[model samples]
Target: MITGIDHVQIAIPRGQEELARTFYGDLLGMSEIAKPAALRRRGGCWFRSGAAFLHLGVEEPFTAAAKAHPAFLVDDLDGLQSRLVEAGHECVRSDGEIEGVLRFHTYDVFGNRVEFQQLCELG
Candidate 1:
């Protein structure tokens, strides 16, 4: 039996750690966590916010994950959307297919799709 997801790994162009930090850390509100010494030489970075962990690994001739993505649960969906828009990131609102849940999709600095969602109070 499986427990839970350890982390979501995303591929990025080589030497783009600073860009990842700005997008995932400064913009997304996640904090950069040091990679293990052995893995540090591989040139990548990790970030964590609460229980959600995202790892960005360096890849040569990288291709963006435009379809596959990780959906993050947020408390303040509207506020987050506003912040992302204010920073020039487009927050594409999701269609109301899933009931009582609000979500939007946005691309990271590397063009990987990321989803943010919030549970709505069903009256």
Candidate 2:
């Protein structure tokens, strides 16, 4: 039986490992995980933070997903949004009624959509 997700993979352009590392590691604060010996030569990187794992695989002629992306449940959504904005990235706010969730959307260097969400503040 499937217990949970092993990881979520997103494709990056060939020879863009450094950019991925900078964005996902330094910027996003995710720790880089070592790939298996066999997989190392394939050209890619893996990362983990807490229980979340994200794999960035190399793809030639890569195309970023506009609508399709992953939504992470963050502890401090406002802080992350501010960080991303201060880094010269765009942060779009959501005005929809999605229960008690507060969220924002942003894009990676590759133009892939990324969502950050947290529970709405109780007043």
Candidate 3:
């Protein structure tokens, strides 16, 4: 039986940890978390923002994930949109058909689609 997601992983080219740190950490405000001792040698990074966790795994010949993405819940969609646009990253507003939420989509350094959403009370 399924309960909840533990974490989401995105494959990135090897030796690109710096870019991941800049995007997920500096830009998005996620804190970089240390990988376990055994996993440390593999070369990648993990990040945490509140309860959300994202793992950037090292993949040879990495291909960007175009359709599949992880949607993160946020408190202020407008503030995030401003932050992202000011940082020069394109944040495109999604044409929402989902009830009670405002959302947008953006790409990481490696072109992985990342979604941010804020829930609002439905009329």
Candidate 4:
């Protein structure tokens, strides 16, 4: 039986590791994890924060996932949003469809859609 997700993989154009590092590492605050030796030649990078892992794989003829994305649960949603904006990333606030969830979507350097959310505390 499937218990939980191990990691989420996103496709990126080849030779963009530095860009990934700057965005996912510097901007998003995720730590880079080394890929296995066998997988090193494949040209990609991995990152982890707490229990969440994201793998960015190099793809030829790459196409960004504009519609589909990974929604990350965050603690300081407003601060993150500000950081993204100051760094020139546009944060699109979500409509109140999920109820009690404050969220926003932004595109990465490669145009992959990403979502960040924070849950509201109930009184």
Candidate 5:
């Protein structure tokens, strides 16, 4: 049987592990998780938010993922956007909001596109 998405990995330029930490952990507020011994030498970082996980890997001749991305749900739209900007990252507004949801997109330190969304509370 198929289950929900476990994790997603993004390719990044080599030696950009710190950048991944800054954006994914410090700025995005995800907790860093230690990679298994077999994967440690590959170079990258892994983060977790509850059961959801994401991995950023380093590679030569890295290519930016313009279309592929991982979307994160947020509680505060404006606040999160402001915080990202304060951290020196650009948050771009996405066209056509889903009914009862506010959405936006941005790029991570490795230039991978990410969608952020806030669901409207039903009264």
Candidate 6:
């Protein structure tokens, strides 16, 4: 009994809220939405795309992903890469068939890796 992805959560070490906002909001252009009432005091942030949501949770020390992450699909890979670089974020290349799509990864300000994807036929 499984449905599609509900949301992807990442842990952000303390003292990096500003950086997270800049990267996820100002740079990446994802809309920042308020977390649920119960999670408001947690001190992190949430961002949403069309049908996907990313929950940035606050933790003592930032932890990298072992087998989890949010893979965001974009229409323009080159243009997106350019914008990310302009925003001072580096995109790392990866090898995989992600959702039957080609994609790459970039670390959020909190050192949490986020993936950017595009269909191979479109590239």
Strongest candidate by lDDT: 4
Q: Estimate each model's TM-score.
A: 0.96, 0.92, 0.95, 0.97, 0.90, 0.83
How many pairs of residues collide in model 4? 0
TM-score (C-alpha) between model 2 and the true structure:
0.92
lDDT of 3: 0.91
List lDDT for all candidates, in order. 0.93, 0.88, 0.91, 0.95, 0.85, 0.79
Candidate 4, which segments miss by more than 4 Å at Cα? Answer: none
| lDDT tens digits by residue: candidate 2, 56-86 | 9988789997898877888988899889999
lDDT over C-alpha atoms for residue 68 of model 6: 68
Query: Which rank order by lDDT, best down to worst?
Result: 4, 1, 3, 2, 5, 6
lDDT for predicted candidate 4 compared with the true structure: 0.95
lDDT digits (tens) for residues 22-113 of candidate 6: 88888888899988899878788899978878888888766767446777888887788888888788887664655457678887776667
Residue-wise lDDT of candidate 4 within 1-123, one digit each (tens)? 999999999999999999999999999999999999999999989999988899999989999999999999999999999999999999999847687898999999999999999998644
- Candidate achieving higher lDDT, 4 or 5: 4
Quantify how close model 3 is to the true structure by its C-alpha RMSD in Å. Answer: 1.0
User: Could you give me the TM-score of model 6 versus the true structure?
Assistant: 0.83
lDDT-superior candidate, 1 or 5: 1
Ten-residue region with minimum lDDT total, candidate 2: 93-102
- Model 3: which residue pairs collide? none
What lDDT tens digits, residue by residue, belong to model 3 across residues 1-123?
Answer: 999888999888899999999889998999999999999899999999999999999988899898899899989999999999998889988746688889999988998999999998888
Please write out the lDDT profile of model 1 over residues 36-112, one tens digit for every residue: 99999999899999999999999889999999998999999999999999999999998476888999999998999
C-alpha lDDT of candidate 6 relative to the true structure: 0.79
If both were scored by TM-score, which would come out higher, candidate 1 or candidate 4?
A: 4
lDDT, residue 80, candidate 6: 84
List the pairs of residues colliding in candidate 5: none
